[model samples]
Target: MLFKNIVTIAASAAIASAEDVYLTVKSDDSSINGNVLGFPHEGAGLNYFFLGTGSATAFTYDESAKEISYPFAGSYTQFFTVFDNFVAFSVASANTEITFEDNVLALNGSTSNFYACKDTNDPYSYSTRSYELMWYASDAPSGCLPLTLVNSGSAAASSSALPSSTSASSAAPSASTYEGSAVKYAPAGAAALLAGAAAALI
Candidate 1:
């Protein structure tokens, strides 16, 4: 009886703590990567709400419950990511891996490791054409073009503007007018309960 009561109380404490975990996306870009949206792309975000150095562009992330939100298919032209600095395991268990290009992610030491993966969500493979997926283990690849993912943005050249001249060429993440934040997923109050219990008891 004593053991069961202890378990019940321990579980409650765990739930409380897990409810509190959230991530703050910080841009590692030294210079603000301004987009066509007329706002800088250098900050932590999902779609619109961004956090920049100090509080210039700071806003709450547009996070929802129990779903990891994907940025609009077309948002960024080219965005930045850090390699091997620190790997923090995801707090939102709803999405185990983050989607950057085709890659899935895993927590690697203090550095969160990201790699290339084919889009499972798409009806067909997004990388079936000219592009190749990359996995940056310790650092960005040597002797390769500086790596950044391209997204759809107002600052980006129009579809008509994409070069017919070469398939290899692509634009960087474009500067754009800052819209409001895109809706993103967060853990549920229930998931928080489960995670919190696991955390405290473990």
Candidate 2:
């Protein structure tokens, strides 16, 4: 019984320490080749951006909870799709479990729901869009480009792939669009505040 218990604990610890996954787009265009998914440091109303690969966010997917989260200030923030136009990291209940297949991040196994909208004025910032359900790429909103998310491996494994200079200005653009979008950030205790605000409004 003691041996069995120890084995169980080890398995649990392995699951808890899952590998981190990085996200990047797959396209023939050289400019967008090295950009990765990330968000600004400020909380709320800021869209997720395709920052340079060196500064891309690292995420872990919990199969048991069916959720994807990134490390924040000593904790984890769940990724959520908001207004069907942008992705955000917050303390909300994020039920969607993003799956990676053949190097492409899919929404419930469908790849057509993801889109990347470029900011024509700022080539370094590319807004991301994720729908709850599958949406045809052909029917995507104007100024948005179909995105194929690829797993760039964990931090240690991806180190060699990083460019010498990780500055956003060094990143180039593969496409051009003029859509304005922003992502919302909610800290650990923001959920209660949001609930209270909603209750008062009602």
Candidate 3:
């Protein structure tokens, strides 16, 4: 069933605070998907990409099978690949007020991208970019959703795609495809389980 258009929990408190950011990818074609995650590394800054094999932390994707694995979960981008020759999206973590200059709009705003990735392995190349994303949690409207989220600004700087020179000889990821599914940092019942574990340990 199509999910009801409801407010995500991320925007529940403080009304205008910018925290807990989440992203989802939708395209005209049903064969593609993109997944993203934000983790707080020892340092700070937002950096995520499929081409950055240089770092050890960015989420890993099996391009040949079109599968993605997130380390620490929340509302995250999932299963991204070369569905398009290149994919481009922008992230501004200044927590500055959202504005037209940011090219931001409602949740249904325009997200567009076109990429000429000379390297089929990494999509971080400036050449392989298309898509305009404006995270609006900073200035969302009343009744906005409050989902468990992590925005680009809060993302760790260590996140990056594997450098193309490094060959991740995994099965080629499934042909660029998309499957949109909201992930939770923890399942609903896990909270109680955790509390019980804590009590036992204590």
Q: Best candidate, TM-score-wise? A: 2
How high a TM-score does candidate 2 get? 0.57
The digit string of per-residue lDDT tens for model 3 on 1-202 reads: 2333234443343233322322322223222122232211110112222221121233332222223334221332223222122221212212111211131112212222221112233322221332212133244333222221112322222223212222222211111121111111112222332233222122
lDDT of 1 by residue, 1-202 (tens): 9999999997776554332112222113322222111111111221112211111111112112222222212231211223232111112232222332322122222223322222212112222321122335556433322223222222222233222221111111112222221101112222332333233122
How far residue 104's Cα lies from its native spot in candidate 1, in Å, is: 20
Candidate 1 stretches with Cα past 4 Å from truth are 30-106, 112-135, 139-202
Best-to-worst lDDT order: 2, 1, 3
What digit string (tens of lDDT, one per residue) describes model 2 on residues 87-132?
5555456645666677677766566566555432331222232211
Question: Number of the top candidate by lDDT?
Answer: 2
TM-score to true structure, per model: 0.25, 0.57, 0.23
Error of 3 at 36 (Å): 4.0
Ranking the candidates on TM-score from highest down gives 2, 1, 3
Sequence-dependent TM-score of model 3: 0.23
Error of 2 at 187 (Å): 17
